[model samples]
Target: MCENNPVRFIDAFVDGLDLDALGFKRVKPKATGRPGYDPSDMLKLYIYGYLNRVRSSRRLEAETHRNLEVIWLMRQLKPDFKTIADFRKANRTAFREVFRSFVRLCRELDLYGRELLAVDGTRIKAVNNKDRNFTKASLKRDLARLDERLERYLKDMSEADTRDDDGPGGDASAKKLTEKIETMKARRERLAGYQKTLEETGEDQLSLTDPDARAMERNTRVGVGYNIQIAVDAKHKLIAEQQVHNKVSDLGLLTETADAARKTLGVETLDVVADKGYFVIEDVEACEAAGAIPFVPKPQRGSAASKGFFVKDRFRYDAKANHYTCPGGQELTQQGGKRVVRKGVHVIGYQNRRACKNCPLKASCTDAAFRKVTRYEREEVLDRMAERLADRPEILDARRETVEHPFGSIKQWMGQGAFLMKRLDNVRGEFSLTALAYNIRRAITLVGIPTLIDAARA
Candidate 1:
C-alpha cells in the first residue's frame, strides 16, 4: 500500500484506540473455544470498507480476497458475511463512541473551530416502505373507503338476489361479489385493529418493518424514514455531533444536538444557528441554558399570516410598559388572564378593543373585533435573540452554507440515500461508520494521512 493511502491511517487510528473501553465485544481471545477475529482488525476492515463505498458485508468479504487494499489492511483475514454482519449488530451502540473518538482526535488536531456550529436535520429513507406505514388518520380514511365499497357491493348482491333468470353464470357472478365483499370486510377489520393499537400505544404512526421509523415529510415529499440531525462546525464543515431521531419534525431537537456538540468541542460558549423549523421557544431557551447561543428565525405561522392580515411581529412590544404598539399606532395592553400555550409556557393576550372599534386599520389588522397579540412569559429571550440576528444577519446564510455540504455529500456522493439496516440502532451504527468515513476523507484532504497517523499515535 502507498504511504498516502487512507487504509494506513485507518489501521493506525484503530490501533491507538482502546476498543474494550469503547464497548467493542470479544476484545480478548478465549482460551478453549475457536479463535475469533480481533475487534481492532474488524474495526479497521469496516472503516476501510465504508471509506471505499463498499458497505455490504458480503462485498467486504469479497474485498478481503480480491481488493489489494482490504487484503493488506485486514492482513488477509476474510470473515464470512454472517460474521461480518453479526459484528455490527452485536456492537451497534459502540459505533457512536468510535465516531466521537475520531472527533476528539480531530479536535486535538485543530480541525474543529469550536466557535460556531450549524445545526440541521435531514430525513433518510429507512428499510420500511411507505405502503407498510400507517397513521391513525390514514387507517380511518382507508376504513371509510372500504365501507363505501362494501355498501356498493352489498347493494349489487341484493339486486342480484331479486333476479329470476336462474342460470349458472348468474350464480357465479353473485359468488364472486360475495367473495369480494368478504375480502373488503376482512381488510376493514384489520384496519380497525390497527386503529385500536394506535389508540392503546398513543403513537402517531406505525411502521411494519421498522417499528422505530416514522412517516415524515421532506421537500414536500412524504416517506417513511428516520430524521438524522447533525451539528457541523463552521470552520471545516465537519460534523461534531450526529443523532438519529424518529420524530416527525425538528421542533425540540436543537438543544440536545447543539449541547452534545458543544460538549464534544470542549467549549464554554458556542454559537448555534438553525432554520425556522427549530423556532420552538422551549427548545431555544433550553439550548441557551445549555451554554449555546441560538439564532433561529421565527416562522410566520398564525391565522393572521395565513389570512393576509398583520402578523404578530408587526406589533412592537414595550417590556417596561407591558404593552404593544400596533401597526395602526395604537397601544394594546395585556388582558386580565394568562393562557397556557404548552407545558411550562404561558402567554397573555393583548388587545385594544375600545380603540379598534373605529380605527380604519382594523380591516388589515384583524377580522375580529380587535387584534390580540399574545406574548410569552419568556418573550424577552426571543427578543434578545432577534436583536442578535438583526445585528449579524449574515450568520443565517453562514448556517446554510455550513450544514448543507455534509448532507449533500453524504446523500449524493456517498450513495447512502437509504439505510440497509432494519432497526434504529443498526441504522445508527451504519450512519456512524458513514459519518466517520466522511470525516476521515475530509481530514485527509485537509491534512494528509501522515499527519493524521502521527496525531493518532500522539
Candidate 2:
C-alpha cells in the first residue's frame, strides 16, 4: 500500500488502540527462552498485509524483509511464517475482539445505519477439496471398488500359480501382485477408518483436508465450505454483524444474525429484511420476541403456481377457531392433534373432506379428494408476521442492495479461492481479520483517512 494511502489509516488506528484492553491475548514472557515477537507488531503487520491485499503469512514474512511499508509497519522485525501463523492460530479470540473493536469505532463514527438490518448468508469455500470430502455413500462405493480390485488381483495370482510358472518374470509378477494386494488392504483399512470416524462423530460427511469444513452450495455450485452469515445495515451498506457456520442452508439463521446485529449496534429495536431462504417460522418468531421486526420473503416450497394450485400461504389461518379458512371459504378442522414432521418441529393435519367434495376451487387447489393442510401449533405467529410482510416488498430490495455489495468487496479481498486457514478457529480468526480490514477500508472511504486518523487519535 502507498505510504500516504488509506493503509496509513489502518496503521494509525492499530497504533491508537490498546489491543490488550480490547481483550486481545498477549504472548506471555518466557523467562529463559528467546524473546518472542510482540503481539502488537504481528497484528499491525497482519492489518497492513490484509489492507494491501497480501494475505499469505509467507508473503507477509517476505514483506517484512523487502517491503518498505511492511517493514515500517512491523518496526523492521521480520517474523517468520511459523511465528506469524502460530500467532493467528493461538489468538483466535483476540482477532475476533479486533473485529469488534473496529465495529465499535464505526459505531462511534455513526457510520452504522442501525435501523434497517439486511441479513443474508454467503458460502465461503474452505481449504478442503471436494474430492477429499467423504460421505457415507462415497465410503461404501470406495469399499466396493477396493474389493473388486483385490478380487481381480487374487484371481490373477491364482491363475499364475496354477500355471506352475517359476521363471524370474513370473516371480516378479507374483511379487508385484502381492504388493498390490497389501497396498489395497492398507487403503481399505484407511477407508474403514474414515467410515468409523463418520459413525463415531455422526457427521453426514467429513473433510480430510479441513475437518470442520462442510459441503455447501453457493448460488448453484456446491462445494466444501462455510455459510458466512452477515447482517448489513441498509443506510450506509456497512456490515453490522457476521457469523460463520457449516450449515448448508439459511433456514434457521434469521433471528440469531438479526439479534447479533442488534447487540452490535446497541439498538433495542431493529428491522431486519432478508430473502426467502431465511424465512423459518421459529426464526421469525424469535426475531419478533427480540424486538426486531423481520421482513423475510416467505420461501415458495411445493407451490404449484404452474399447476394452478393456490399456495399454502394464500389459505388464511384462523387462530380463534383453531381451523384453516381456505381460499374458497372452506373450514378445514384439525384431523390430528400433532404429528412429528421432523426433529423438534411438529405439525397438525387439517382437512375437510365434505367441504372439498362440492367446492368449485378443488380443481385449482388439489387433485386429491380432500386437500389436507398441516399447521404448526404456533403457526399464528408466522401468519401475523406474514401479514406485516405483505406490504414491505421494498425491504427485500434494500436487503439485496445492502448485503451483496459488502460480500462482493470482501470476496475480492479474499481472492478467487476461499480461506487460507485450515480449521474452524483459524478460519474464524482469518475472517475476523478480513472483516476488520474491510471495515477499515470502508471507514476510510466513507470519511477521508484524515478524519479516521483524527478520530483514532482522539
Candidate 3:
C-alpha cells in the first residue's frame, strides 16, 4: 500500500496547481539564513499530515525525514519543526484560499449541488479550560478571596505590633512577617491589576491560555471553546463556508450562514434549513430578502405549553384586518407601528385590554392585567417561512441528514480538545487545513483517487 499510496494525489494536487495562484506567498530568498523552504512544499506537507491525522508540527518534521510517502511528497527536504510551524503562521490566509480553491475545484467537478443547503454550528474545544476562563463574577470572587487573605496578613502584623514580646521565635520572626506582608500586598496588587485589565477590555469573559476562547455551552456540556459554523451542501456534502465565532448563541446565525452559502455556490438564491436553535425572526427576514428560502422550525418560546394556555400558534392572524384573533373570540389590535423593542430589534404590540377585561379566557390568557401579543416588524417574513415549512416539512429531515454528516466526520478527526494551534487566528488556519483535508477525503471517496488526480491534472 505504501508503494502505491493514494496520498500521492495530494502531492499532484498541491504541486501541479499554482500555489501563488491559490494566494500562497512564494519565497525567492537571497543568500541568507539557510535558504527557506518553498511555501508550496510546506503546504504539501501539511495537507499530507492532516489527511493522515499527523497534525503535530514536530511529528510532521519527523515525517519529512522518515516516512517514505512524505519523503516523496516533500522531495527529501527535511525542514525542522520551527520551519514547518512558521510556514503555517506566515500563510494563514493562504490556507483559507486553498480551502476555497478546493471548493471551486469541487464545483468544477459538479460535486457541489448548489440547491439545498444546511447551516449548523458545532463546538470545537479550545486549548483553554474552564478554570482559565474568567467572567466578571469569577474575577469579583477572586478579588474577594484576595481581600480576605490581605486582611489575614494585616491581622497577623497587628497582633505582632501589640504582642510586645516575640514568643519562641524572637525578633527575626517579626522581620520575616514584615517580608511576608510586603509579598502578600504585592500579590493582592497583581490580582487587582488583572481585575482592571478585565474591566478595561470590556470583555465579559477572558481566557489565560487562549484569549479568544469563551465559555460556551453546547447541548449539555459547557467548556472553553469556539463555535465553528459551517454551511454544508446537500449533494456532495462539501463545506461551503467555515466561520469561527466566540458567541455561544446560534439564534441569529442563520442569515449569515445562508448568505455565505449563496455566495460560495455562486447562485442567486438558496434553500436553507436549520434546527430550532437558529429560528431568529431577523435571520428569516434577511434570508427571504436575499431571495433564499429558509426552512427553520420556529422555536417553541413562552410558557403557554407548560401553563395549558393558548400558544402563539393557536392564535390566527388576519392580514387584511391587521390584527390577531385569540383562541377566544377576541381581536388583538396593534398598539403601534414598528417600534424598537430592544437594540436592533423591532416589535409591534397587539392588545385588546377592554375585551380582555370582560372576556372569560382572561384568567387563562395572562397573569397580567391583559393579554398583549407582540408581533415583530418582520413577522410577515416568518409567516412566509411558516407557509413554506407547512408545504415541505421533510426539508428538516433532509437538513439533519446532509449537514450532520460532515460535522460527525470532522469531529472524528478532532479528538478531545484537539485544536493543535493556540490563538484564534492560528486555529482558524488549522481548521481550514482540516476542511481541505476533509474535502479531499470526500472527493476521493466519491470518486477514486486516480480519478481525482486526473481531474486535478485536467
Candidate 4:
C-alpha cells in the first residue's frame, strides 16, 4: 500500500476501536472451536467495502482474493462470503455506534460547525418489490377486477355448456374455463384475507417480502421503501446523524432528528432547518423544547389557498385584543356556535357576519354568508416559527444545499439507490455503514487521511 492510502487509515481506525465495548459479537473469540475471524477484521472489511462501493459480502470476499488493497487490509485471511455476511447480520446494531464514533472523530478534527444542522429525509427502495406490496385501495381494486374476470369466465362456461355439442373441443374449453375460475377464486380468497388483516390491524399497507417496508412516494412515484432521515452539519456538509424509519411521511420527525444531531455535535443549542414537509406545529414545539431552534417554512395548505380566497395568513391576530384583523380591516372575534374539535384539536372559529355582509373584499374572501377562520389552540407555536423564518430566510437555502449533498452523494455517487437487505433492522445497519462511508470520504477530502489516522489513534 502507498503512504497516503486510505486502507492504512481504515486499518488503524478499526484496530483502535474496542469492538466489545461497541456491542460487536464474538470480539474475544472462542478458545475451544476453530478460531474465528476477529471482529475488527470484519468491521474493517465492511468499512472498506462500503467506502469503495462494494457493499455485498460476496463481493468483499472476492475482493480479499483479487484486490491488492483488500489483501493488504485483511492480511491474507480469506473469510468466505457467508462468514462475512453473518458478521454483519449479528452485529447490526453495533454499526451505529461505530458511525457515531467517527462522528466524534470529525468533531475532534473541527470538521463540524456545531452551530447549524440541516435535517432532511429521502426514500430508499427496499428489498421488497412493488407487486409484493398490498394497500387497501390496491387490494380493493384487484378484488374487483378478479370478480369481473370470474364473472366473465362463468358466463363463458355457461355458453359452452349451452352449446351441448358433447364433443372433445367443447369439453376441453369448459375444463379450461373451470380451471381459470378456480384459480381466480383462490386469488380472491388470498386478497380478501389481506383486506381482513388490514382491517384488523388498521395498517394502511402490507408488504409480503418485507413486512416492515411501506409503499411511499418518492419524487412523485410510489415505491415500497423506508424513509431515511439525516442531519447534516452546515460547515462541510458532513452527516451528523442518520436514522431509518418506516414512517410514510416527514411530518413529525423533525424534533427527533435534530435533537440527536444536537447531542452528537455536543452543543448546547443548535439551529435546525428543514423543508416545508416538516411543518407540523407539534414537532416544531418539541424541537424548541429539546433546545434546538427549528426553522421550517409554513406550508401553504388550506382550502382557502385552493379556492383563490384570502388565506388564513392574510388575517393578522392581535395578541392583546385576542381577535383577528381581516384583509378588509374587519374584526373577527370568536363566534359562539363555531367551536369544533378537528382531529382531536380544539379549534375556534372567528367570523364577523355583519362585516362580511357588506364588506368590499368579501368577493375574494369568501362566497358563503361569512368566512370563518379557524385556529388551533396551539397555533402560537406555528406563529413563532413563522416569525423566526421571516428573519432568517437564507437558512432555508442553506438547508437545501447542506442536506441535499449527502443524499445525492449516497444515491448517485455511492450507488445506494436501493437497499440489498430484507428488513428494516438490516437496512438500518446497511445505511449506518453507508453513512459512515460517506462521512469517511468527506472527512478524507476535507482533512487528509493522515489527520484521521492520528485522531483515531488518540
Q: Assess each prediction's global lDDT (C-alpha) against the native.
A: 0.91, 0.82, 0.81, 0.91
Model 1 C-alpha lDDT per residue in residues 230-293, reported as the tens digit of each score: 9999999999999998899999999999999999889999999999999998999999999999
Candidate 3, 1-458: lDDT as tens digits: 34236667877677676777777764433336666678878888999998888888899999988898899888888887877877888888779888877787788788989998888998898888788887888778887887887788788878878987567886888788788878877867866776788889988887889988888888888888888888889997889888777888887887876787688678898798889999877777778788668898887787765676677887788989999999788889998678886677898889888988888877788777888887887688888889999999899889989877788888875442458777888888988988888888898888778777777777
Give per-residue lDDT, candidate 3, residue 77.
85
Candidate 4 C-alpha lDDT tens digits along 1-458: 88699999999999889899999995323344667888999899999999999999889999999999999999998888888888888999999999998999999999999999999999999999999999999999999999998898888888877887588677787777788899999999999999999999999999999999999997799999999999999999999999999999998999988998899889889889999999877788889989899999877898888899998889999877879999999899987653546454567788899999999888899979999998877788889889998999999889989988999999999999999998889998999999999999999999999999999899
Error of 3 at 62 (Å): 0.5
User: Which structure among the candidates has the greatest TM-score?
Assistant: 1
What lDDT is obtained when candidate 4 is compared to the true structure? 0.91
Off by over 4 Å in 4: 27-32, 165-168, 336-345
Worst 10 residues of 4 by lDDT: 26-35
Report lDDT (Cα) of residue 383, candidate 1. Answer: 95
Report the candidate with higher lDDT, 2 versus 3.
Answer: 2
Q: What TM-score, computed on C-alpha atoms, does each candidate reach?
A: 0.96, 0.87, 0.87, 0.94
Per-model RMSD to reference: 1.9, 3.4, 3.4, 2.3
